[model samples]
Target: GKKVIIIGAGIAGLAASIRLSIKGFQVDVFEANSYPGGKLTEIIMDGYRFDAGPSLFTLPEQIDELFALAGLKTEDFFRYKRLEVNCNYFWEDGARLSAYSDLDKFTKEVAYQFGEQPENIKKALDKSAYIYKYLAPLFMHRSLHKWSTWLNKKAMASYFRIGKFGLFHTMNQANQRQFKHPKLAQLFNRYATYNGSNPYQTPATLNIIPHLEFNKGAYFPTEGMHSITSSLYTLAKQLGVNFHFNKAVDKILVKDKVAIGIQAGGKSYDGNYILNNMDMVTAYKTLLNEEKQPTRLLKQPKSSSALIFYWGVKKVFPELDLHNILFSKDYAKEFKAIFKDKDIDDDPTVYINITSVQKANDAPEGAMNWFTMINVPNDQGQDWEYLKAKARKAIIRKINATLHTDIEPLIEVEQILDPIGIATKTSSANGALYGNSSNNRYAAFLRHPNYSSKIKNLYFCGGSVHPGGGIPLCLLSAKIVADMIPKP
Candidate 1:
């Protein structure tokens, strides 16, 4: 078997290394940062811990499969519990909604809160399930470029059922058709942001997101979200996978259009295959500079980025749940500012996630660890400092008004993550959270492929490439990359 070199120690890289090692291939992962996990990381501030990125966890089966492949028991290393209450929502009109994990309970709640019929909710879920059934095999489980995939009977069936996938209209339109109440429509439309997209413009195929959460059930990692990274890293190391930390890969050596190795820390590490788990944009621009880049795909519009504030609160709110969203009155205007105007909305909807509720060790006995986030436009030469300060004040005011608590005074510690910070830390271009925006119908096909068409032995994984971002899809991206590698 040939030696494999992987760039970046993110979840995708770790997963690839584990899979390759189990297949009897020698795997060496080169990570620029001292720690692994990239965005799936943790930050400890004065004893309060926060999973710096991706608070919500869904699809535990995908993670368990990785452990099983490594010949390890999933329970022995990692564990998670399904969330009973997925999230709590607050509206501007003094209305509140507790999104329960139980489907019947949630449907009844929606019906009770808004005068919408439960049958309408059931119909929407049925449609979403149909979309998932057709698209999963074609778009998710296999590579679209592969000949075998296209030739398969399942692929042919998917091709015929493409109309049901809603390739023509936007997600907002689809939701509006499903629910008569504007609030209910807005509630479903919010799922589009799970991947950092605008529902009004993004394809209705995105409606499948809610089915992933409410149907499959959302989860909370027992030790916290960062435990996911820690457990995977441990499993990878235990499987005889080597990791070179703080070693930035400077270039991907190409000989006769074939990748031979990678150059990092003034030395060459040769390998039969190269998996780039770094951002696709940075991987090509920095590592494979001599190769011709995918200009059209690279130039495609990016999804919205987030401006986050990690606060160590001195007091805990009993009214707040593990996940909470404070919706803005004008949802259309808010998205318009992000997608069309390319700026932060004046009244941006705020999402506050408190991990201390689930894991008491995350904060002191009387305090809470708050992960506050708001969607914003990707970096396009905006004045971030000014916008961040202004947004912070507005968020404080909004929370105070809605919760009836002056939250500003209880902030014991404060840290921020903006678009610039996101880009610098994760190597993502324009700090796009989930790669290119799904605003257009062609975005699914327009995304950069896991394997390079131009450069042999060079491959891509992680959020920026196929399968797209978020924890579940990022794991799927790694699976696609690993499957593409030649067997020993």
Candidate 2:
């Protein structure tokens, strides 16, 4: 059997290992961190457990496909339940809106809270669903560069409907046109952050994100987000896949422009195929030193990063849901601060998630774990310590004002993760959550391809490469790489 060496034990790497092993390839995974899951990790503090990254769960069918490929039942290994309420939004004008999973309930909630016409909300959702219908088969299911894509009838139909997909206008502009209320526009425009793009700059193609969450439904894992990593890792190990933890890969060994193996921990491991799950910037600048990098593509602006504060609160609120958002007054200014100014906004939108709401064991008898986060620009040599302090103060003030509760006294433990920490921990350049910013309409085509055109037998997967970021897309990237590998 052919041997495959996968760099980084992230979701993409682990998923690739499962697919390749099923195809009769001997797979070995190397991880720099002691644990797997990359950003989809968990933390426990003072009797409260918090999911470190990726608080939202959507499109679980992608995960089910992986388990089915391994001949295992998804329910037996991992389990998740659909959320009744997707998220709770708190606007600066003291408006509270509940985003229900049910389409009718959500439309009614929009009407009740924002005074938006139900017909308008229905029309907007219809447009979002239309975009999804036009693009899903072409953009999400398969690689765009494949010859079969051009030949497929569905793909051609998607190409014909591309203009209607809102590729020209920004998501903010599209939302404003669909909804008369500014708050309603803000609600839909916020979907741009699903992939960490600025709504003011990101194309309206991102409006399709709502359908993935609302129509398809949002989910919460039974155990926690980390359960995804644990279940997949367990399955991979059962398949005879070797995992080498704390082994940092130094370089990709190449012979005549073909990948041979990887150099890690001052040792060389020979393999027939190499899969890189590391960020594209680091993979090129560090691993493939001799190879010519894509300079123009690499120079594109990166997606926004995040500043997360994990607080072990001594109390819980009945009004708060599992996922909550405290939106800033000026959404456009917030995006400008992240993209153009490259600074943390004083009035940044804050997202707070509590796992204890679903899984009781995640916290003590009456306590809660608050995973508070705010979007910021990717690292560009900013003074983070000062910014972190300022941002924390602002976030706390916003939460207290919106919730009408003094929350400062309830903290039993506190920890902070900034852009620098995210970069250092995951080796993502500038600590970008998603690889590159999709502000440009051509970003989908311009992203680094899954298979390296310059190097033979070398493939790339994860947020930094094709198909884009988040758990589902990262898993799709792995599938693309596995499909590209020839059968023995």
TM-score of 2: 0.98
- lDDT comparing candidate 2 with the true structure: 0.90
- At residue 32, what lDDT does model 1 achieve? 90
lDDT of each model, Cα atoms only?
A: 0.90, 0.90
Tens digit of lDDT per residue, candidate 1, span 328-368? 88899999999999887778899999999999999988999
Report the C-alpha lDDT of model 2 over 20-78, residue by residue, as the tens digit.
Answer: 99989999999999999898898887688889999888888888998999888999999
The residue-level lDDT of candidate 1 at 372 comes to: 93
Model 2 spans with C-alpha error above 4 angstroms: none
Give the clashing residue pairs of candidate 1, or none.
none
In angstroms, give how far residue 72 of model 2 lies from its true place. Answer: 1.3
lDDT over C-alpha atoms for residue 142 of model 1? 77
Q: How far in Å is the alpha carbon of 163 misplaced in model 1?
A: 1.8
